[model samples]
Target chain A: MDLNTVKERAGPREFSPADDLPREYREAATRMIEFHANSEIMGAYLERPFIRQAPSIDRKLAFSAKVQDEIGHGQLLYRAAESLGVKTREEMLDDLANGDGKFLNCFHYPLKSWVEIPMISFFVDGAAMRRQATLRRTSWEPYAHAMDKVCFEEGFHVKHGEDILKELMTGSRAEQQRTQEAFEEWWPRIIQFFGPTDDKSTHHDFAASVGLKQQSNDELRDAFLDQYIPKARKHGLEIPDEPRIRERDDGTYAVEEGDLDWDEFFTIAKNDYEPGLGQINGRKQAQEAVQWVRETIEDDATTAGGHAPQAAD
Target chain B: MAALENPADLDEREREALETLLKRLADDEFVLAERYTEWQVRAPSLESDLALANNAQDELGHARLWYDVLEDLGFEEQELVYERDPADFRHATLVELPFEEGDWADAVLRSYLYDAAEELRLEALEDSSYPKIADRVGKIQSEEAYHLEHAQNWVERLADGEEGHQRLQDALDRLFPHALTLFEPVDPDVETDIVDLGLRDATLEELGEEWLSIVVPYLESLELELPVSSQVDDDTFEITEEMLPEKRGRDGSHTDAWADLHDELTHTYRDLGRSETTKIMEKPE
Candidate 1:
């Protein structure tokens, strides 16, 4: 109930909506979960086009299913965040549309070609899954529960993504060349996915102190690089030269923070970057277009003497 | 008529009729699923978005089943889909038309119209002469019942309000004619053989009349007007030449939109010079 007691009691799946949580803990948890939820939507938006552009029917079906899963993840997460009682799902989604919401930095860039798909689907999702696996023990019960399902579904996505990457890399020389180029362009943004180092992360201490965050920015980044770097090499993708990665004596990895663009990262974090703004407004316009449909259903429900039935999870 | 138990026993004429019927079924589901995926993150609410996406995947899975049946005729995925000519596709125009941004009315109304026809069509095929077609009908129909309910539920709700009613009316006017193309003949001789062989128990004309009998009354009950009321005679519906679109997809003719869509979907195959389409799921037994 009190902030000191809340801090002391924070542990894996320790808190739920039933708990009379302190405001600080709720707000922090809401922020973390909302960001995670927004990322799911934005990531889905990025992959939506490829559902149509996928070369084969099998690829198209997989892409559509994968994007659908991401939207489902967003649904689960927003419910988790709303259970915190800080902000409702509508408010969070509206915030995302209005450019006040933050998501992962990798989604801020434009995905132009089919070749660029695995860069986001495989490498970036692989990084996100690395962090998500640890969040299974998050202090918030609903958030961890959502992670339970998300982590299960995410393995398919990562595997499917790797399958696509393998197809491209083993194809003709031109296909392989284009895929490598896509990797080079997306590598820096993918590295920035973990955000700044432990020292530079502002909310890490408080979030970790509350058990909402299981790993620090530095720890997650190092773990991701150690695992995915070799996977990239195994796929014949050449890692970019800049953002120089250092191989530690323990066979771990670190990036030179100066080599990355924090200005651009912060700009996207604030939802002001141009291409990212396009992504945000595109979704906003779609939401506005279908406003009447929601109102119509709501009105019908009221006239029928009850609330509209919520969609089954 | 008895059902045909094995593909190996079919003569050339029966084989041609069966292939034509399967192409229509498979292409309609595949293309409609492609269009439905456009609504993934764009639906009005998060829950609705998920529902529509589920429907999309269901349609795609159904398409896979039909396409698998065609593979028994010695066709490969690449020859059937990726490298197939755009004009060779047999899907109806209703499924090919692109949705205007935020047009939830079109999405709902179109689904209502298509799913109603789907129900009748599936029932006609319940005793299909081809055992493969007959066996798969029950599985597909079970999933389709939910699609019909979801569409009907939305259409009734949308028609209840003035703005929603107006939107639904507009979508109905634009999409109704295209929906009729669903029953158009791919080949007159082949269609005749399809019925003569009992591949489907009813003819397209019979199915179209039954579909109109059902949808016409339902639309009128919601205070929605039918664009083709002039074509209705008593309880039976007949489609005239004017009621048809310029592009009858069953005849290997299509709108400009189909060309663009086909090219976009096949872009990856072309760019990568793929000789075969990837198979994610195993061949259906």
Candidate 2:
């Protein structure tokens, strides 16, 4: 509602809006917002293990701040989606923890390395920012307003992440190896971050009708590839697949469709619901870790004359 | 740079109060700051998240300064901060409770209650025999005033609007008991010792009572109930230094929350072995 969504999409290219969008759009928007919310929440679990293991005061401080930001963002976006009447935050989590729900392609995958913190901030947050910035002009008032805030913060995270990567790349030879290992670990998933490119995927129409997502998968992936390739290479970080990454003397790169890895993308997306140990096991583990705190909140709430809802829904 | 180099200039009573007060200040600020950091990535939105994180950082900075003063008084910072058993901690029960991860209102309530008590305590310290600390407290008070104002803004905004006020009222009811406990007695004998020497302006219990009078009126105006409390048997207050394990937390008693918190908190630092020095901050540029 704030920015021009129709103009941007048309300028980039045209795609058919699902016919009779009023109903379908709302359904898909609910699902998409839930997925993004889950991504933000689960993103914490992936990165959290490292904060305790961080090697320095600065690392601890930075990671603490970073994970906190991730969780915080999830809260914000969930509330935004709730404002749109798509889903309640509690319901979204119930769907995530219990019912079938999908997050972004990036989160269901694993994360390793301190370097990945910034890389996620750089590459992933950068990609995330693209989607978010566009959402800043989203047709839905609440989602658009929320994105404005999300985008501003992501800018800082990206810069901080870039600086970390920049230092590692330009640091000593040992730093180079560390940087490379970090790059290699996250690169495949990063490639999948644009999400699988499908014109008529099952969830597509549902998304557009409700104002959940504007850009097609391929469109966003192309935008990401176009922006990130040079920055990745500037630090001598390899793209790993030359054919997949189009290079130009003019200094930009394009994603070759054939080279794009959809199997990995789908594998990750499917796992967004299932995780790797399976959703059942992952759900059990997450529940156990939080059970005591949950119980405490419930018990205290009752005694205090107010209580938070405990039902999965 | 011990440039504030003069002897901390407290009489025995004030000097003793400094030891108890600063640790209470440090631990209270430190732990709440730690808990608040969990909200960093998961806050309802990035701007709000960033704002809360900045507040967390400010608490940590305040903790570090308080600790610096402790170290200046010849105590080792690490031992003073980490090694003490829970029972030895002087912090109130308010700072120790576990947080519900995504509950922004809970976080806001924590801030509002803590900020109110913090302002009260710092105001009392402003005229203490410890000049250096007084000066430092004065500067911190201003920044903390902003934090309190921020908390008040949210409280009034949330509490004034429809069902919003109920949610805030609920949080206040839950956390207010601990907040009241925050003002309970610290040292029993210090009042006579410090007042006689002009080191402290009032006795610990007296100050607690004074603290109540100042805050209760404002809280009443908001249509909120103040936690019932008196000095030692302070009605709403039950926590004391003797409850903690005698260490880093006030009198050191802590829940399992502290361990989970410390693990997440120290994660990055644990890897950077003590032998290596890592840069803590980037140049301002």
First chain TM-score, candidate 2 = 0.79
Deviation in Å, model 2, residue B213 alpha carbon: 10
For candidate 1, write residues B1-285 as lDDT tens digits. 876777888889988999999999999999999899999999988888989999999999999999999998989888888989999999999999999998998998999999999999999999887888888999999999999999988887778789989999999989988999999999999999999999998999999988888888789888888865623566557777898888889999998999998898888788778788888777776
Whole-model lDDT, candidate 1?
0.91
Clashes of 1: 1
What DockQ, on C-alphas, does every prediction get? 0.71, 0.17
TM-score of every model?
0.97, 0.64
Model 2 misplaced stretches (Cα beyond 4 Å):
A1-21, A44-90, A137-142, A167-176, A198-216, A235-238, A241-244, A248-250, A255-261, A272-313, B1-24, B38-58, B64-120, B128-132, B135-264, B272-285
lDDT of 2 by residue, A1-313 (tens): 2124432442211222222224334445556666777777777656665544554434556766777767667777787666555567767776666635667666765565565666676888888988887666555555566677777877877887787677667756766776687777777678677665556366655455444567777777777778887789886898775236666676666666666566666665565334543533554444544444344444545765774532210
Docking class of 1: medium
How far residue A178's Cα lies from its native spot in candidate 2, in Å, is: 3.7
Docking class of 2: incorrect
